[model samples]
Target: MSMKNLDRHNRWRNKTVAFRVSPEEDEQLEIFVKLSGLTKQDYITRRLLEKEVVVQGNPRVYKALRDELAAVLDELRRIEAGQGVNGELLDTIHMIATILNGMQEEIAYGN
Candidate 1:
C-alpha cells in the first residue's frame, strides 16, 4: 500500500476505549450530542478530555424544588375544591416563584 493509505489504515485500526452507560444516560448523551452540534463519539471524547465544558451541580435540589412545587399545585387544586387557601401554601408558592426567578435571571445574565 502507499504511505498515505498505510497511515490511514493504522489510524483506523487504533483501539477505542469502551464505557458502560445506563439507557437513560445514553439518551441524555444523545440529546447533548445533538444540541452541541457534535457526533456522539466526538462529544464523548471531548467530555472525557474536559475541554470547555460546563458542568452543572447535582439535580437533586432542582428535583426537590420540583416536588415542592407539585405539592403546592396539589394544595391549590384542593383549595379550588373548597378547602380554602392556606398561608403555608402561599408561602411555598412564593418560594418556588423566587427560586425560578433567580434561575431565570442567572440564565439571562449568563451566570
Candidate 2:
C-alpha cells in the first residue's frame, strides 16, 4: 500500500481529485508549475485553495524563468514576422512579470 499523506494542517489527504484539460491547457499548467518552482500537486492545491503561492527563489526557478523568457522572445519575433499574438503567450508574459515583480520587491525589502 502507498503511504498516506497529510497536509500542512495535519489533515489526512486520502481523496483523489482528477480532471481533464485540453493539451493546450495542460501545457499552460506545466509552464506555470515550473515557473512557480513548486511540485505539480502543491501548485494545483494552492491554486485551488486560493492560497498565496509565494515562490522561493532557487536555481531551478531561475532556469525556468530563463527558458520561459527565451520562449517569449521567440514568440515575439514570430509575431513581428506577421504572426498574431496568442493568449497563451500573453499569459506566460504576465505570469513571468508577476514573478519578477515579486522577486524585486523581496530584494528591495531584503527578504
Candidate 3:
C-alpha cells in the first residue's frame, strides 16, 4: 500500500498502548474509572499523557531551589549586560541548568 493510503486509512491515531493487570487490580481501576466520569481509555490516556497528580516533595526544598535558580538567572542577565565576559560564571550557570533539568525530569517521572 502507498503511504498516502495507509495514512488516510489509519488516521492519526495508529498507535496502541496495551498492558495487562491482575483481576483484582482491574476491579479497583474500574471503580476509579467510574468515579472519574470518563471512559477507561480517556482516563488512562489523560493520566499517562497529561499528569493529573504531582509528585510529592517538601515545600521548603522547592522554595530554596527556586530562589537559587532565580538568583542565578539574575546574575546571568547582569553578566550578559556587563562589558566584561565571564566564561567561568557562564559555565557554572550552564552546569546548574543541566543539573536542574535532570532533577525536573526525575521529579516529573516520580523517580
Count of backbone clashes, every candidate in sequence: 0, 0, 0
Worst 10 residues of 2 by lDDT: 1-10
User: Residues 19-99, candidate 2, lDDT per residue (tens digit)?
Assistant: 999999999999999999999999999999999998889999999999999999999999999989999999999999999
Tens-digit lDDT track of model 1 for 1-111:
344433323654245689899876675565455434444665676788886533232365466566676777888789888988865566556655666676778799998
Candidate order (TM-score): 2, 1, 3
What lDDT score belongs to each candidate, Candidate 1 first? 0.61, 0.95, 0.58
For residues 1-75, write the lDDT of model 3, one tens digit per residue.
445433324655446789999876675566445434455766687688785723233554355446556766776
Write the number of the candidate with greater TM-score, choosing between 1 and 2: 2
Off by over 4 Å in 1: 1-58
TM-score of each: 0.47, 0.94, 0.35
- Cα RMSD, model 1: 12.9
Query: Candidate 3 at 5: error in angstroms?
Result: 17
